[model samples]
Target: MKLSGCNLPGITVMVFVMLSSSSTSAITNFNVLNFGAIPTGGTDSTDSFLKAWNAACGTADSTFIYVPKGRYLVGPLAFKGQCKSSQIIIRIDGTIVAPLDYGVLGKSNNWFSFEDVSGVSIIGRGTFDAKGPSLWACKASNSNSCPSGATTLSFTNSNNIRINGLTSLNSQMFHIVINGCQNVHLEGVKIIAAGNSPNTDGIHVQLSRNVEILSTSIKTGDDCISIGPGTENLWIEQITCGPGHGISIGSLAKDLKEEGVQNVTVKKTVFSNTQNGLRIKSWARPSNGYVQGVRFIDSVMRNVQNPIMIDQNYCPRNENCPGQVSGIKINDIVYEDIRGTSSTPIAIKFDCSDKNPCTGIKLQNVNLTYLNKAAQSFCSNVVGKAIDLVRPNSCL
Candidate 1:
């Protein structure tokens, strides 16, 4: 199937020629060195990287774009596709660094982007070092000239994608984003950033479906994994998160007309020294969004704050929509086999919206403590029940 071309930065046209299923084709290798990319980190390799991509994209055979072991400096890159081959692999064993001047890539939407691509896999133990501390410092100083930092990598309007064994360090914004895609899988990924770095979510998925994230470790400033509206059929397991905000859903209800998030499952995750664990939050404003059929199971938390939380009346900094109610409905959520130690006395908090209260919530075999003492549960505008063996006393 041929995908229509879209105008991409540094790209004139996209041509994809699909390979036949019955064909036995040899893998074509496109090495960045062959395209005049310098291995040293000082030189700009943007053009060389694009040249390699173009060469690989135009081929009918299976292709591999290889990045050898060295430090390489690159700027903003967009890999747009309707490629000739159905299978393209990007294997990287090098460290890719951004320019020292943060403004060079910080002002852009993303440092590296894949758009309108399909059947692609990125593998190997590569490191993406996006030197974001300068930008973070600029923002901390309250400089009006600071640009909104760019995401490290993003995939959009694509399908059948896989990312494995990649390390991202000090991303300017979100580390990895999956947007408007389907059948995406990410595993064995590591993300590291300062705990105070602003808006640096490890992974953010939205308007996507059938996504699976497994065996990932994240230590970031913001949510380790954030689920946005229109996300469905997501599975997250075996994740380790610390020095970050734990996995969250929503901050939804920003737009009046928004999509609902449903059928999400998070299991076997561990959190330590994090802000929150297993949270669902939405803005206190008018919206048509809803969250349903979500499950958080077999998770452990250590020294975390708000181990289980639902803040439908989330008004960050109490700036917008004071005294307003959230229109997003939340229901059919379950928490099972969650054991944790909370940093705060209140281990569980359900501060749902007064207008459209949360219902159909269930808790089973949950235990949480504060300073080795009995924790507490606070509830408001929520209707739920505890099945068995609930600590901190169920307030449903």
Candidate 2:
């Protein structure tokens, strides 16, 4: 496969083939715990499961702590460098629920939290239920008095995480979050929060590096993937997004200082009924950060607003926006293999600041068809046209 040419839903089914390579892989120990066979329905084995996992943390390619078919109630499961070399795989065959009133740990509403950990893999075909009714009620009554909710799963200050074949549902906040972590890989994951749910982003990644999300389907109330600050070498492929905002860069960013995001790529992804497509947003103030080397290739956008947007003047909370352009430059963005239908006429908009005009940007081999009409970009003050880019700039 041509790395960048593969389609979503196509590559996900082949995860086992590409992911199971023995080339410098994690160590393995198989400890199968059939939650159904154990006959412990009422008792929560959160600690027992962790004990079994720790005992089998030998260095091997197949270190698996399998949870076979049953509703096993668990508490927050944490992973650190200690479980790093174990190549951990928790094959959840059934549902994993939390104890009552724990509030799914720290999942949704207000700010979510993540403890420090690294080098883990949570791959399973089962469901992780946050069961967030109590938390929801609290939020419905008084947003201020409720305690912070926990996520169903979080990747915190950790690296080399591979999440596959899982249905992460009804998280208190974001379904999946990667924060202060590096070298993360998400494949064949499904995240679905309640419709019109508040702050329920499907996959929110922040302060991370070298992250790859592959063959995932995300449908949430918020952005399918909200890429936050300090991310580098982020690659997304074969993703199906809908019923939310499409792959966004940021909504709130302080400065272009330690907040640089580079080498971002989204390819072979299909977006349906999304708010935006191929979005890059930034705040205009003390100019604390920069976003560079962003690309969206081989993508299809449908019934989306703003199929392409580069908004430099972002902080949209106030009618009269503040902050002068502090020269947070954006460069090297590419939109190619784009075939879509947008509901709106002004489907493609790049509102880069005049002070810091979007430089080194290109739209190649690109054809955007919106409202039964074909469209091409008419940019202003761009460094290069779609064809004159340093990278190959073509539409065919």
Candidate 3:
């Protein structure tokens, strides 16, 4: 059976076709246009998209949801599953735009959320325009009535997922969030936002395992990639980041008993004019958390501030955890072949927790410079070793 058509203005249409007995023989396509979705981005297409998702998800056959070449205005959408079809693909050739007024999505949690899904692949050369400039202006003006912004895209409690070639622009908050998931891969993804936009992290991963982010370029205000607690076996490579905070692990130790982050590898990356190149930060609080078996290798930095850092007493603005010390144990970290130009005098800083000092930190073949001169290194409450021609005089 074949299904394809566009609906008339102000009319909602639902098309259904019976499949053959052997569903695997053919892949069915569910286009949102047939379900009354407006292509001009002037009207709400949330219901139309949801209907298409529901129909495609309910089928046991391999299904494809197609968003054709047009601009679609969508509201906050939650695509939940425990789907009947294990192999479902959503291909978008159009741009999905958020409401012109950021408040519509700002008050919500996520613009596009996928929860409890498995074996779903989203591949497209599409764009997600979140219209975040207004929200950033509001927050910049210290507007107390402003809502906490929503993430542009989020995947939670999902497994065997793949997101490829998707572009996110001007996100109100984070561009992509991977939480409570396993075996998720993101590749050839592009995230763009202003350099000073508040909290627009390119990607945030937490409570996930075996997640891979490869061949991605990010320009944002916050960390290009932020690794949170309970993330294990994450591999990030071939990434380009600039006009933002660089790759970071932690800001952990939030709770008294927190899950640790382990086995993360970030290599073959490049950073330019960023706030921090490679960092691991945590709040100064009494916690039973730890970070171990992390590696940062073969990365290049250009005019980045704090090329290498481990700030355990991360009490921003002296807010909470005043005078408190972090109890998080950070160990077994390696930085190899990191060559960089620092924007600051201190290229490397390791301010580890006094209660549980950092141990087994190794640096090899690190060359960093500041202002055409030799930079400096600072170490406090840490124990480590330097090998193979470290610059700025390793303070281990």
**Every model's TM-score:** 0.93, 0.79, 0.93
lDDT of 2 at 333: 84
- Per-residue lDDT tens digits for candidate 3, residues 1-396, read 111111211111111221223344556778899999999999999999999999989998878888888999999999999889887878778999999988999999999999999978777789999999999999999989998999999999998887888899999999999999998878889999999999999999999988889889999999999999999889999999998999999779878898899998899999999999999999988889899999999999899998999999887677655578898899999999999799999999999988899999999999999999999999999899999999989999
Residue range 62-137, candidate 2, lDDT tens digits = 4656676777667676544554343455566677765676444644332223345444566668887776656666
Worst 10 residues of 3 by lDDT: 6-15
Q: Which sections of candidate 3 miss by over 4 Å?
A: 1-24
Model 1 poorest 10 in a row by lDDT:
9-18
Q: What is the RMSD, in Å, between candidate 2 and the native fold over all Cα? A: 5.9
**Residue 241 error for model 1, in Å?**
0.5
What TM-score would candidate 1 get against the native?
0.93
Q: What does candidate 1's lDDT look like per residue over 266-369, in tens digits?
A: 99999999999999999888789999999999999999998999998887777756467899999999999999799999999999988899999999999999
The predicted structure with the larger lDDT, 1 or 2, is 1
**Alpha carbon deviation, residue 245, candidate 2 (Å):** 0.8
Off by over 4 Å in 2: 1-42, 57-62, 83-86, 99-119, 132-142, 316-323, 373-384, 387-396
- Backbone clash total for model 3 is 0
